[model samples]
Target chain A: MSTTLGRISHGAGLILVLCFTLFPFYWMVSSSFKDQADILASPPVWFFTPTLANYADIFADEKVFGAIVNSLIVATLTTALSVLLGAPAAYALARFEFRGKSDLWFWFISNRMISPIVLALPVYLLAVQLRMLDTYLVLVLIYLTFNLPIVVWICTDQFRSIPSEIEQAARLDGADQFTIFRKIYVPLGLPGIAVSAIFSFIFSWNELLYALVLTRRSVQTAPVMATSFMSGYELPWGKIMATGTLIVLPVTIFALLVSRHMVRGLTMGATK
Target chain B: MRKGGEFVERTETRLNPGYGRWTPFWFLAPAVFALLAIGIYPMLSALVTSFRRYNITRPREGFPFIGFENYANVLSDQTFWQSLGLTARFFVTVLPFQLLFGICIALLLHRPGLGMLRSLARVSLVVPLATTYAVVGLIGRLIFNRDFGVANQFLNAIGIGGMDWLGSPTGAFIAIAVMDIWQWTPFCALIFLAGLSMVPVEIEEAARLETSSKVALLRHVQLPYLLPGLTAMLILRSADILKLFDMVFVMTRGGPGAATDLVSIYIQRVGFRVFDMGTASAQAILLLIMTIILSRLYIRLIYKEIE
Candidate 1:
C-alpha cells in the first residue's frame, strides 16, 4: 500500500511540475493564436477559433524583419568570433603551464561574473562616440564580454578531458604541435565547444538591455522590438504574444535539439 | 590532471627549446587583448566616470572632476536605498523558493523507476530555460493579467478571487518572484539532477537500507555529495538574480510606484532618463563591488576544497 501510494504521489508530483513548467508556454502559444476579445475573455476561452492575424501583422512590419535579421547576424557573428578567439586560448590554458596560468584562468572565468549593466553604460557611451551604434559589429563585440569567457572555460575543460596519450602518440610520429592541435584536439573538443557556441548564440539572441540601449529603430533586435509592444498605448496582446512566440521558437527548438547536452552546458561543465 | 599539465610542460620545453616560457603567452595574448578592449576598458571608463560629472545630455558643461560627490549623492538618495532594499528583498524572496522547489523536483525526477514520465518531465522543464527573460516577462503579464489571465482563471475555477498581480507593490513583487521561480526552478533542478547522478548508487542504497526515511537518506548520503553542485548553482543563480534587468523592465518597468525597482533599473533610469552619468556610474561601481564580494564569498566557501 505504501509503495503504491509512493508511486501515485510521485506520478502526481511529476504532472504538477510539468504543468508549472509548461502552462505559461501553453498560454503564450494559445494566446498568440487567440483573437483580441477571446484573449481577454474572463472565463479564459479554452476553446476558440484560432487566428493567425497576430503572426500576420507582426510579419507585415518591415521593422520586424530587420529585427530578426539583426538578431541572427549578431548571434551568429558573436558565436563565430568567440570560438575563433577563445578556443586557442582555452587550448593553451589546458595544455601548457606558464607563469600566472591559474591567475589567467581565473581572470577569464571571472569575466562571467561581471554584470552586463556594469558594462552597458561605458560600452554604450563608447558606441556613441565611435558612431558604432545600430551596427552588428558593436553588439557582436560587446557580447564577447560573456561569450569569450564561456567558450574559454568550457573548451578548456573539453581539451583537458581528451586523453593525452593520443596527442603524445601524434607528437612521437613527428606531427607538429599546431597540426596536432588542429587535427586532434579540435575534433575531440567540438562537442563541448558546440555547447559553448550554443550558449553564446542564445545569450546574444535573447539579449535586451544592451540591444535596447545601443540600437535605434534601424538595428533593433527581435527581443528589443518585442518590448516596444508593451509601451504602446494599446496593449496589442495578440501581436505581443505572437512576437513573443516567434522570439522563443528558435531557441526552444535549439534547446530541445540539444536537450541531452542542456544539463552539462548549463552547469558550464562543472557537474560533469 | 597533473600528468596532463606535466605533459604540456614537457612539450613546451621540447618545442621552444629555451623560450617555452613565452609559448602560452602567444596563444593567450589575443584573448587577453580582447578582454582588455571590451571588458576592462569599459569598466575602467565607468570607474573614471563614477568619480566625475559627465552627463551626455548636458554636453555644454564638460565632464569635470568631482571627487566622491556622485557616490555621496547615491548614498544619500532614498530612492537608491529603496531600490537596493527591494533588490535584496527580491533576491531573498525568489532564491529560497527556487532552491527548495528545485531540490524537491530534482529529487522527484531523480527517483529510479518511472522511465517515460521522467524523460517527459525533464524535457518539459527546460523549455522555459530556453526562452528569453523578456519573453518570460511578457508571458508573466499575460498569465497574471488582472481580468482574463490564466492564473486568475485557474484561481477562480478553484473558487478564489483574482488578485491585482502587477498593480499593487506587494502583488507586483510576488508576481515578479513567481515568474522568476517558474522560469528558473527548472534550471536549478537540472543542475541538481546532474549533481545527483554523480553520487555513488551504493552509498544511496546502503543509506536506504539503514534508514527507511527518504529525508534521512538525503541528509546522510546525498546532501554531502551534492554540495559542490548546490554551491555552483547558488553562485550562478545569485550572480544572475542580482543583475536581473530585462524581466523587471518588461514586467513592471520598475513599477506602478517604485515598488519593484531594482538597482539595475535604478541605474538605467538615472543614467538614461535623468542623464546623470556620474550617479549611475557611482551606483554601478557600488553594485560591482557588492557582486564581486558576494561571488568571492560563494566561491571561497564552496570551492575551498578544490583550491
Candidate 2:
C-alpha cells in the first residue's frame, strides 16, 4: 500500500509539473499552426485547421532567413572560439600549480558575474568608432568573452576529475606535456568541453540585448528579428508565434541531444 | 588527485627538457589576453564616462570631465531608484516560489521507480530553457493578453472572470513574476535533481527504514546535500533577475506607466534610448558594485571544495 501510494503521488506530481511547464510551449506551437481566424479566438482554440500561412509569411521576408544565418554564424563561431581559448587555460589551472593561479581562476569565474548592460554600452561605442557594428565578428568576440568563464569553469572540473596518475605515467613514458594534453586530456575532457560549447552556442544564439543595441538591419540575429514583429502596430500574432517556434526549435533539439550533461552545465559544475 | 599532477609537473620541470617553465603561461595567454582586453577596457571606458558629460546625442558637448556630477544626477533620479527597488521586489517575491516549485518537482522526479518518466520529463523541461528570453517575452505578450489570453481564460474558468493583465500596474507586475517563475522553476528543479543524485543510495535506504514521511526524509537526508546547489541556484537566479532585460523590454517596454521597469530596462533607456552615457555609466557602475559583493560571497561557497 505504501509503495503504491508513493508511485501514484509521485506520478501525479510529475504530470502536474509537466503540464504547467509545457503549457506555454504548447500554446506557442499550436498558435503557430492556427490560421488568422483561429489565432485570435477568444476561448483559445484547442483544435483548428492547421495552415502553413504563418510559416509562409515569415519565410517570404528575406530578413528572417538572413537573421537565421546570422544567428548560426555567430553561435557557431562563439562556441568554437570559446572552447579553443578556454580549454588550455582550464588545463593549466587544473594540472599546473603556479603563483596566483587561484586568483586567476577566481578572475575568470567572476567575469561571468558582470552585467551585460555594463559591457554593452562601452562595446557599442567602441564598435561604432571602429565601424565594427552589426558584424558577425563583433558579436562573436563579445560572446567569446562571456562564454569563456563557463568553458574554463567546467573544463577545469573535468580535467581535475581525470586521475593525475595518467599524467605522471604519460610523462614517464616520454610524452610531452602538449602531446599528453592533446592525446589524453582532450579525449577525456571532450565531454566537459562539449558541455561548455553547448552553453556558448545557446547563449550566443538567444542573446538579445547586445544584438538589439548593436545590430541594425544587415546583421540582425533571429531573436532580434522576432522582436521586430512587435514594434509594428498590428502585432502579427501568427507570425510572432511562428517566428518564436522557429527560433526555439534548433536550440531545443540541440539541448536535448546532451541533456545528460545539462544538469552539470546549467549549474556550471557547481553541483555535479 | 592534484598532488599527482603537481608531482608530475615538478618532475617535468627538473628532469624533462620538454616541460618548459613558460608552458602554462603560454597555454593561458590567449584567453587571459582576450578576457583582459574585453573586460577591463570597456570597464575603464565606462568608469571614465561616468564622471564626464558624454551624451551621445550631443557629440558637440565633447565628453568633458565633470567630477561626480553624473553619479549625482543618477542618484537624484526618482526613476532610477524606483526601478532598482521594483527589481529587488521582483527578485524577493519570485525567488521563493521558484525555489518551492522547483524543489517539489525535483522531489517528484527524484523519487524511486521514476526511471523512464524522469528522463522524458527532464528532456522536455529543456524546451523552456532552450527558448530565448526574447521569445519568452513574446510568448508572455500572448499568454497575458487581456482579450484572448490563456491566463484570463483560466481565471474565467475558475470564476475569477477576465481581467486586464498587462494594462494595470499590479497585473503587469504579476505577469512578469509569473513568466519569470515559469522560465526559472525548471532550472531550479534540474539543479535540485542533480543535488538529490548526490545522496547515496545506501544512506537513503537506511533512512527510509527510520521514516515513512517524505517530508522528514527530505528535511533530514536530502536537504543537507542540496545546500551547495541551493546556494549556486540562488546566486545565479538573483543575478539573472538583476540583469533581466529582454523579456521585460519585449513584454511591456517597462510600461503600463513604469510598472515593470526593472533595472536593466531602466538602464537601457538611459544609456541607449537617450544616449546619456554619463548617467548610464554611473548606473552601470552601481550595478557592478552590488554584483561584485554578491559574487564575492558566491565565490567562497563555490570554490570551497575545489581549492
Candidate 3:
C-alpha cells in the first residue's frame, strides 16, 4: 500500500510538471495557426480552425524569405569557420605542450564572457569606416569571435576524451600531422564537430545584437526582421508568430535531434 | 633496408618532434585574428572612447581628451543608478524561481516508467530554448497587451480585474521577468538534467532505503552533488542576463517612463539614440567592470568548489 501511494504521488507530480512545462510551447504553435480574431477572443481559444494564412503573409509580404537566406548564410559560414579553426586549436590545446598554454586557453574562453554591447559601439564605427555595414562578411566575422571560443572549449573536451595512442600510432606509421588529423582525429571527433557546428549555427542564427546594429535593410537576418514586425506604431501579432514559428523550427528540430550530444557538449568539462 | 628505415625515422622525428607545438597556433590564428579585430580592438576603443569627450553628433570635429569626465558624469547620472538598481531587482527576482522550477522539472523527468513522455518532455522544453528573443518579445507583447490580450482575458474569467501588463512600471517589470523565466527555465533544466545524470545511483538508492521522503533525499544527497553545476549555470545565466537587451527592447523599448530600463537599454539609448558616445562608452565601461567583478566572484566560487 505504501509503495502504491509512493508511485501514485510520483506519477502525479511528473504529469503536472510536464503539463506546465509543455503548455506554453503548445500554445505558441496553436496560436500561430489561429486567425487574428480568434486569437483575441475571450476564454483563450484553445481549439480553433487552423490556417497557413499567417505563414503565407510572412513569406509573401514580410520579406521573411530574404531574412531566412541571410540567417542561413551567416550561420553556415560561422559554423564552418568555427569548426575549421577551433577543432585543430582544440586538438593542440588538448594534446600538445606549449608555453603560456593555460593562459592562452583561459584568454580564449574569457572571450565568451565579454559582452557584445561593449564591442558594439567601436564595431559600428569600424564597420562604417570599412564600409562593411549590412554585409554578410561583417556579421560572420563578429559571430566567429563568439562561436570560435565555444567551439574550442567544447572541442577541447572532445579531443581530450580520445586516446593519445591512436594518434601516436598513426604518426609512427609515417602519417603526417595533417594526415593524422584528417584520418584519425577528425573521424574520432566527428560527433564533437557536429555538436560544435550545431551550436555555432544556433548561436549565429539566434544572434540579435550584431544583426540589429550592423544590418540596415539588405542583409538583415530573421531575428532582426522579426523585431521589425514589432517596431512600427501598431503590433503585428499574426505575422510575428508566423515568422517566429518558422524561424524557430530549424534550430528546434536540430536541437531535438541531437539533444543528447548537446547535453554532452554542454557539460563537457563540468564533471571532470 | 634497416639503415634506410632508421634514416627515414630520424627525419620524421626531426620534422615532427612530438605533436608539433606550432600546430595549435596555426589552427588558432584565424580565430585569434578575428577576436583581435572584432573583440579586443573594439573593446580597447570603447575604453579609450570612454575617457574622451566624444559626441556622435560632432563626428568630423575631434574632441579633446577629457580624462574621467564621462565616468564622473555617469557616476552622477540618476538614470544609470536606477537602471542598475532595476537590473539587480530583475536578476534577484528571476534567478531563484528559474533555478527552483528548473530543478523541479528536471527531477520530475528523471523518474522511471515515463519512456515516451520523457522524450516529449525534453523536446517540448527545448522549443522555448530554441525560440529567438525577438519572437519571445513579440509573443509576450501579444499575450500581455492591455485590452485584448489572453492574459487579461484569463484574469477576467477568473474574476480578477485586468492589469496593464506593459503599461505601468511594475507591470512592465513583471511582464519582462515572466517572459525571461518562461524562456530560460528550460535552459536551467537542461543543465540540471546533465548534472543529475552524473549523480551516483548507489547514493540515491541508499538514501531511498534509509528514508522514503523525497525532500530529505534531495537535501542530504542530491543537492550537494548538484552544487557545482548549479553554480556554473548561475554564473553563465547571470552574465547573459546582465547583457540582456533584445527582449526588453522589443517589449517596451525601456518605456512606461524608463521604469523597466536596464543598463544595456540605457547604454543603447544614450549611445545610439542620443548619440552621446562619450557618456555611452563610459556607461559601457561601468557595465563591463560590474560584469568582470561578478564573473570573477563566480570563478572564485567555482574554483573553491573544485578544490
Candidate 4:
C-alpha cells in the first residue's frame, strides 16, 4: 500500500513539474494562433479554432522580417568568430605551461560574469564615435566579450578531458604546435565547440539591451523588434506572442539539440 | 639526481625550436586581442568616464575632468540606493525558492524508477531554461494580465478574487519574482542533477542505512553533497539577477512608480533617458564593484566550507 502511494505521488509530481515549466510555452504558442478576442477570452480559450493570421501578419511585415534576418546574421557571425578565436586560446590554457595561466583563465571567465550595462554606454559611445552604430560588425565584435570567455572556458575543460598524451605523441612526431592543435585538439574538442557555438548563438539571438540600444532602425534584431510591439499604448497581444514564439523557436531547438550538455554549458567548467 | 637531470633535459629538448615560449601566446593572441578590445578597453574607458563630467548631451564642454563628482552625485541620489536595494531584494527573495525547488525536483527525478516519466519531466523542465528572458517576461505579462490572464482565471476557479498582478507595486514585484523563479528553477535543477550524478552511491547507501527515510537521507547526506552545485547555482543566478535588465524591462519597465527598478534599469535610465553619461558610468562602476565583491565573498564562503 505504501509503495503504491509512493508511485502515485511520484507520477503526480512529475506531471505538475512538467506543466509548471512548459505551460508558459504552451500558452505563448497557443495564444499566438488565437485572434485578439480569443486571446483575451476569460477562463482562457482552451479549445479554439487556431488561425495562422498572426504568423501571416508577422511574415508579411517587412520590419519584422528584416529584424529576423539581422538576428540570424548577428547570431551566426558571433558564434563563428567566438569559436575561431577561443579554441586555440582554450587549447593553450589546457595544455601549455604559461606564466599567469591561471590568472588569464580567471580573467577570461570573469569577463563572462560582467553586467552588460557596464559595457553598454562605453561600447555604444565607441560604436557611435567610430561610425559603427547599427552595424553587424560592431555587435559581433562586442558579443565576443561574453561568448569568447564561455568558449574558452568550455573548450579548455573539453581539451583538458582529452589526455595530453595524444598531443605529446604528435609533438614527438614531426608535427608542429599548430598542426597538432588543428589535427588533434579540434577534432577531439568538436563536441565542446558545438556546445559553445550553440550557447553563443542563443545568447546573441536572445540579447535585447544591446540590440535595442545599439541599433535604431537598420540593425534592429528580433528581440528589440518584439519590444516595439509593446511600446504602443494598447498591447498587441497576438503580434507580441507571435514574435515571442518566433524568437524562442530557434533557441529552443538549439538548446534541445545540445540539452545533454546544458549542465556543463551552464555551470561552465565548474561541474562535469 | 640523474633521473631529475635527464627529465629536465628531455623536457628542454621535447619541442623543436619552432614551437617555443611564444607558441602559447600566438595561440592565445586572437582571443586576447578580442578581450582587450571588447572587454578591457571598454571597461577602462567606462572607469575613466566615471570620474569625469562626460555628458553625452553636452559634448561641446569636452568632458571636464571632475574628480569624484559623478561618484558623489550618484551616491547622493536616492534612486540609486533604492534601485540597489530592490536589486538585492529581487536576488534574495527569488534565489532560495529556486534552489529549493531545484533540489526537490532533482531529488524527485533522481529516484530509482518511473523511467520514461522521469526523462520526460527532465526534458520538459528545460523548456523554460531555453526560453529567452525577454520572451519569458512577455509570457509573464500575458499570463498575469489583470482582466483576462490565466492566473486570474485560475484564482477565480479556486474561489479567490483576482488581483492586479502588474499594476500594484507589491503585486508587480511578486509577479516578476515568480516569473524569474519559474524560468530559473529548472536551471538550478539541471545543475543540481549534474551534481547529484557526481555524488558517490556508496556514501549515499551508507548514509541511508542510518536514516532509512528519504527526508532524513536528503537532509543529512544529499544536502551536504550538493554544496558545490548550490554555490555554482547561487553565483551564476546572483550575478544575472543583479544585472537583470531584459526581463524587468519587458515585464514592468521598472513600473508602478519604480518599485521594481533594479540598478541595471536605473543605470540605463541615467545613461540613456537622462543622458547623464558620467553618473551612469559611476553607477556602473559601483555595480561592478558590488558584483565582484559579492561573487568573491560567495566563492570564499563556498571554498572555506569545502576546506
Candidate 5:
C-alpha cells in the first residue's frame, strides 16, 4: 500500500515536470498560428482557429529566403570544413604520443571558453581590413574558430574508442597512415562526425551576435532576420513567432531525434 | 637510466604506430594554421588595440598608443563594476536552482516503474536545449509582458497577483534568471542522469537494503560518479554565463534599467553603441582572463582529466 502511494506521487511529479518543460514550446508554436488579436489575448486563448497567415506574412518579406539561404550556406560549409580538417587532427591526438599533446588539446577546447566580446571587436576589424564583411566565406571561417574545437574533442574521443587492432590489421595490409585513417576510421567514426556536424550546423545556424555584427543584408542569417523583424512600436508578434518557430523547427527535430548525441554535443562531449 | 629509457622506447614503438615525428604535424598543421589565422591572430590584434585609442566613430584621432589608459578607464568605470556584479549575481541566482532541480529530476527519472513516463519526459527536456537562444529571448518577451502574459494569469490563478515582470528592475532580473533556469536546468539534469546511469544496479539495491533513505544512497553510492560530471557542468556553465549575450540582448537589451546589464552587454554597448573599441577590448581581455582563471582552477581542483 505504501509502495503504491509512492509510485502514484512519482507519476504525478513526472507529469508536472513534463508540463513545465513543454508548456512554453507549446505556447510558442500555438502562438505562431495565432492571428494578431488572438496572440495578445489577455487571458490567453487555449483554443482558436489556427491560421497560416503569420507564416505567409513572414515569407512575403523576400529577405527571409535570402537569410535562410545564407544560413544554409554558412552552416553547410562550416560543418564540412570542421569534419574535414578536424578528423585528421583528431586521429593524431588519439593515436599518437607527442610533446605538449595535452596542452594542444586544452588550447583547442579553451577557445570556446573565451567570450565572444573579446573576439568581436578584433574580428570586425580584421573583416574590414580583408574586405570580407557580409560574405559567406567570412561567416564560415568565423564559425570554424569554435566548431573545430568541438569536432576535434568529440572525434578524438570517438577515434580513441575504436580498437587499435583495426589499425594494426590495416597497416599489415600495407595501408599507409592516410589510407588507414580514411578506410578504417572514417567509416567507423561516422556517428561522431554526424554528431559534430549536427552541432556545427546548429550553432552556426543559431548564432546571432557575430552574424548581427558582421553581416548586413547580403549574408544575414535566420536568427539575425528573426531579430530584424523585432523592431518598432507595433511589434509583429505573429510573424515573429512564426519566424521563430521556423528557425527553431530543424533544431528541435534534431534535438528530439538524436537526444543522446545531442546531450553529448551540448556538454561538449564531457558527459558521454 | 639506460634500461628504463630502452624499455620506454620499446613500448613507444609498439603503441605509437611507428610514424615519423612530423606525421602528427602534417595532420595537425591545417587546423593549427586555421586557428592561428582566424582565432589567435585576431585575439592578438585585439590585445594590441586595447592599449591604443582606436574608436571606430572617431577616425580623425588616429590610432595613437594610449598605454594603460583604456584599461584604467575600464577599471574606473562604475557601470563596468555594476555590470560585473550583475553578471555574478545572475550566475549565482540560477546555478544552485538548476543543480538542485536537475539532480532531483534525474533521481526521479532514475526511479524504477515509470518507463513510459521516462521516455516522454526525456524528449521534452531537449526541446528547450535545442531552441535557439534568441528565440528563447523572444519567447521570454511574449510570456513576461506586464499586461498580456500567461505569467500574470498563472500568478492570478495561484493568488500571488501579477506584477510587471520586465518593467521593474528586480522583476526584470528575476525574469532573465527564470528563463536561464528554464533553459539550462535540463542540461544539468541530463549530465546528472548520465552520471546516475553509470551506477550499478547491484550497488543501488545494496544501498537501498541498508536504509530506506534516498539521500543517504545518493550521498554514499551515486555521488562519486556525479562529482566528475558536476565539475564539468561547473566549468561549462561558468564560461557560458560570462559570455552570455544573445538571449539577454534580445530579451532585455540590458533592460528597462541596467538591471540585466551583464558584462557582455556592457562591452557591446561600449564597442558597438559608442564605437569605443579600445576600452571595449580592454574590458573583453579582463573578462577573458577571469574566464580562463575560473575554468583553469575548476579543472585543476576537481575536473577529472579526460583520457
Candidate 6:
C-alpha cells in the first residue's frame, strides 16, 4: 500500500512539474492570438476567439521584416567568421605542441569569462569613431569575442577526439597542411563546426545591448525593435506578444531540430 | 649502404627543417589576430577610459584624466551600494531554488523505464533555454500582469489576494527572479544530468541492495558524483546573475524607486542614459573587479577539489 502511494505521488508530481514548465509557453502562444480586449479581460481568457490581427499589425506597422533581415545578416556573418577562424585554431591546439600552449588555451577560455558589459562603452566609442554604427559588420565583430572562444573550445575537443594518425597519414601522402585540413579534419570535425555555427548564430541573434547602443534606425535587431513598441502611454500587449513569438520562433525551431547534437556538443568534456 | 642511408636521412631532415615547429602558429594566427583586435583592444580601451572623465557630448576636450575621482565617486554613491545589495539578494535568493529544482528534475529524468517521456521532457524543458531574454521578459510581464495575468487569476482561485507583481520593489524583484529561474533551470538540469550519467551504477545498486532506501543510495553513492556539477552550476549561475540586465530592463526598467536596479542596470543608466561616461566606466571597473574575485574563488575551490 505504501509503495502504491509512493508511485501515485511520483506520477502526480511529474504531471505537476510538466504543467508548470509548459504553461508559460502555452500562455504566450494563446495570448498571441488574443486581441487587446480579450487579453485585458478580467479572470484571464483561456479559450479565446483566435485572431491574426496581432500578427498582421506587427508585420504591417512594426517593420519587423527589416529586423529579421538584420538579424539573419548579423547571425550569418558572425557564424561564418567564427567557424572560418576558430576551426584552424582549434586544430592547432588539438594536434600540435607549442610553447605557451596551455596558456594559449586558457587565455581563449578566459575571454569567455570577460563580461560584455565591460566592453560596451569602448565598443560604442569605437563604433562611433569608425562610423561603423548601425552596420552588420560592427555587430558581427563585437559578437566574435564571445562566439569565437566557444567555437575554438568546442572544436578543440572535437579535433582532439579524432586520432592524430589520420592527419599524419594524409600529410605523408604529399598532402599539404591546408589540404589535409580540408580533406581529413574538416570532414571529421563537421559536426563540431555545425554546433559552433549554431551557437554563434544564436548568440548574435539574441544579442540586444550592442544592437541597442549602436543602431538608431537602420540596423536594429528584433529584440531592440521589440523594445521600441513600448510607450509610456499604452502598452501594445497584442503586438508585443506577436513580435515576441516571431523573434523566438526561428531559434526555437533550430534548437528543437538540432537538440540532440547541441546536447552532445555542450556535454563534451563536461562529464569527465 | 650506411653512408647512402645517412645522406638520405640528412636530405629529409633538411627538407622538413622546423616545419613542425612553425605549423601551429600559422594555424593559430587568424584566430589570435581576431581575438586581439576585437577582444583585447576593447578591454584595454575600457580600462583606460575608466580612469578618465569623458563625455561624448563634449568631444573637443577629449577625455580628461580624472585620477581615481570617478572611482571615489562610485565608491561613495549610496545608489551604487544599494544596487550591489540588490544584486546580491537576487543572486542568493534565486540560485538555491534553481539548483534544487534542477537536481530534482535531473533525478526524475535519470530514472529507468521512462523512454519516450524522457526525450519529450528534454525538448519541453530546453525550449526556454533557447528563448532570448527579450522574449522571456515579455512572457514574464504577461504572466505577472496585475489584472489580466494568469498568476493573479490562479491566486484568486486559491483565495489568495492578488498583489502587484511589477509595481512594488519586492514584487518586481520576485518577478525578475522567477523569470530567470524559468529560463535557466533547464540549463542547470542539463548539466546535472550529464554529471549524473557519470555516476557508476554498480555503486548505486550496491547501496540499494544494502540499504533498500532511495535516500540512502543518493546520499552514499550519487551525492559525491554530483558535487562537481553542483559547484560548477553555482559558480556559473552566480556570475551570470550578477550581470543580469535584459530582463530587468524590459520588465521594470529599474522602477518603483530604483529598487529593482542592479549594478549592471545602474551602470547602463549612468553611462548611456545620463551620459556620465567616466562614472559609468568606474562602476563597470568595480563590477569587473568583484566578478574577477568571485571567479578566482570559484576556480580555487574547483582546483582544490581536483587536487
Chain B alone vs. reference chain B, TM-score for every model? 0.91, 0.94, 0.90, 0.91, 0.94, 0.89
Native contacts matched by each model = 0.71, 0.74, 0.52, 0.70, 0.74, 0.50
Which of 2 and 3 is the better model by lDDT? 2
| Model 4: how far residue A269 lies from native, Å | 2.3
Q: What is the lDDT of residue B90 in candidate 3?
A: 90
Worst 10 residues of 2 chain B by lDDT: B12-21
Ranking by lDDT: 2, 5, 4, 1, 6, 3
Alpha-carbon local distance difference test for all models = 0.86, 0.88, 0.80, 0.87, 0.87, 0.80
Error of 5 at B275 (Å): 0.3
Model 2 clash pairs?
Answer: none
Q: What is residue A99's positional error in candidate 2, in angstroms?
A: 0.9
As for DockQ, the candidate ahead, 2 or 4, is: 2
lDDT of 5 by residue, B79-170 (tens): 99999999989988999999999998898888888889988887788988888989988998889988778888899899999999989999
- Chain A TM-score values for every predicted structure, listed in order: 0.95, 0.94, 0.94, 0.97, 0.96, 0.93
Task: Tell me the lDDT of model 3 at B139.
Answer: 77
lDDT of 2 at A213: 88
lDDT of candidate model 2 versus the reference: 0.88
* Candidate 3 backbone collisions, by pair: none
User: Who wins the DockQ comparison?
Assistant: 5
Candidate rank order under TM-score = 5, 4, 2, 1, 6, 3
Off by over 4 Å in 6: A1-7, A260-269, B1-18, B59-62, B294-307
Model 3 C-alpha lDDT per residue in residues B218-276, reported as the tens digit of each score: 88888887888787777777777778898899889998999779888888889888888
Q: Record all residue pairs in model 6 with backbone atoms less than 3 Å apart, i.e. clashing.
A: none
Highest TM-score among the candidates is held by which one? 5
* DockQ of predictions, in order shown: 0.67, 0.69, 0.50, 0.67, 0.73, 0.54
- Which regions of candidate 2 are displaced past 4 Å? A168-174, B1-18
What CAPRI-style quality would you assign to candidate 6? medium
